[model samples]
Target: MPNTNGILGRKLGMTRVYNEFGQASPVTVIEAGPCVVLQKKTVGKEGYNAVQVGFREKKPSRLNKPEVGHFKKSGGTGYYHVREFKVEDPKIYELGQQVNVTEVIKIGDKVDVTGRAKGRGFQGVIKRHGFSGGRATHGSDFQRQPGSIGSSAYPSRVIKGKKMPGHMGTDKQTVKNLIVIDIRVEENILLVKGAVPGAKNGLVSIYIKKA
Candidate 1:
C-alpha cells in the first residue's frame, strides 16, 4: 500500500499443501506484515525514496530512551524488528500507517525470502563443506580430518577462502524465486512453495521479485 515491494515477517515452519490435482507440495509458512511505517525518506530530502517499517510490536518498557524517542513520532509504539524498503514514492505512505501482507504480494507471485540460516556451531569439513572422508577400513586414521590444507614449500600458508572446518551456518541467506502458493489475509499468513532458510520462528524479509 506504500509503494513498497517487500515486507518483514517470521518463519512459521513448513507444511504440505494439496492442489486441485491432489498433488502435495511442500511449502514454508510465513507470518507476514501488519508492519507499521516508522519513517519516510523522500528523494528531495534523503536523496532516495524509501520507507522504514517496523514489525512485531514490543513493550515500551523494553525499549531504551533513544528507541522510545525514535518511535515517539510513530504513535509511540515500539517494535522488535525495523527494516527499510525502497519505494517509488515515499510521500504516499504516512507515518504510523500499517501495511498488510496482501498490499505488497499476492498468490502466484514470485518472491525472494531472506533469513539467517540455522547455526551448526563449530562443524567439521565433512558436515560443513560436504567433503568425503577418507577410507574407514584398514586402520585409516584420516576419517574425517581435512587432509592437506596447503603445500609446505609453495604457498607456505593456508589459502584464504579455503573451505575448512569452522563455524557453520547462522549467516544471512536468500532463497530466490520462491512461488507464493497461498495467502490468508485475515491471518496474515503466506504459504510459499519450497523450503526457505533459517529455523522456525526466525525473522525473514520477503521481497517480491522485480523481474
Candidate 2:
C-alpha cells in the first residue's frame, strides 16, 4: 500500500535555525503526528480509498455517548482531533494503528500546511485588501474609509465580489510547497521553513507534496 503522506499536528511556535554556515532561516515549529488509525474506507464500500485518523487523545468524560461509542471500536481511546487522508488503498492500515510523522515525511521534502489564519474582526479595505489610504496631511477626511463603493450610472449597485472588506482572517488557508527544515523524531516535532497559517497552538494539517 502507498503511504498516506499526511498527518495532523499543532503549531507550537516559530523560531530560527542555522545551517552549517551559520546562516539563519526562520522556521515554524509543529508538534506532529503519532496519530492512530480510527477507520478506513475502500472504494468498493465507501466509494473511495481513505484512512481516518485521530490525534491528541481526549478524556472519555468530555465526549458524548456517540463519540465514546465510536472511539470504542478503536481501542476505547478518545481523540481531540480526527481527520481523513486519501490513500491509494485502505487495506494496509488496521484500526488503532499508530502513524508517526517520520514514517511518511522526511527532511527537505515539500509539504502543504493547512490551518485557519488568525482572525482580525471587521476591518476596512485599507487593512484587509492593502488599499493605500488618503494622504496623511491635514484635513484629509477620506482617511481609512473605503471610498465610493459603486457608481450611480449603469450598474447602479455594488458589484459582486468587490474588494470592500467586512471581515478579515479566520479563514481556512493552505501554504503550499514549504520545505521541511528539520524533524525531531524523539519529540515528534517538525520544523518547516517560512511562516504558516494560524496563531500559536492552532491545529494544522500537513501533507507531503505529491510528485
Candidate 3:
C-alpha cells in the first residue's frame, strides 16, 4: 500500500494515552474513514490530478438530484461530507473504493490536519488579534480600545491587511507535522499527538505531510 494524498475524517475530540515509556501523551482522536472514493480527476481532463472522497452517511432526501445521481453512479448512498484531495497518481484509485486510515497512515507518521477553527464571533482587538489592551488603572479611559487605527492625513485611510477588531475564528486552519500516536483499524480511529483545529465532531482532513 503506497502513501495516499489524504483522507477525510471526523474529529472525535481529544484524549490522553500512555506510551511504552509510561509517559502520557495528549492526543486528538479522529474517527477516520471508511471513506468512499467518489471520483477521480486527471490533469488532461480536469486540469489537475485529484480524488474526490466522501465521508459519513447522509439521507437520500437530503441530497439534490445531481448529488444523488453522482453518488449512485459511484455505488454509494448519500454522504454528509465530500471533498477532493490532490494526488500524484489519481489513476491508482477507482470510484467506489473504500479508503481507511491504515492503508495510508500509520503510527509515528506525521500528518497535516485541516479544519475550521471554533468561531469566536465579533471580538475586540485584544482577544482577536492579541493586542495588549490599555492599562486598567490610572484613570485609563482608553482601555480595551483599538487605539490609533488611522493616522493624520498620510495614507488617509485604514491600511489594508491591518489586524483590527472584527469577526474572529471560524477560519480554515491547518496544523502541520502532528505525529500520529496510534491507530485502531478495528474502530477506524486515529490518535494524533497534540491539538487540532475545529470543535469536537467537526470535519477534519488528515494528509501525510509533504517532505
TM-score against native, each model: 0.96, 0.95, 0.95
**TM-score winner among the candidates?**
1
Q: Which candidate, 1 or 2, would have the higher lDDT against the true structure?
A: 1
Best by lDDT: 1
lDDT agreement of model 3 with the native? 0.90
| Candidate 2 TM-score versus the reference | 0.95
lDDT value for model 2: 0.93
| RMSD of every prediction | 1.2, 1.4, 1.4
Off by over 4 Å in 2: none
Which lDDT tens digits does candidate 3 get at residues 59-163? 887899899889997894889999998888888887888888898897898999999999999999989988888899989898889999877898899899888
> Candidate 3 regions off by >4 Å?
1-3
The lDDT for every candidate, in the order shown, is: 0.94, 0.93, 0.90
Instruction: List, residue by residue over 68-148, the lDDT tens digit for candidate 1.
Output: 999998899999999999999887988999999999998899999999999999999999999999999999998999999
lDDT of model 1, residue 79:
99
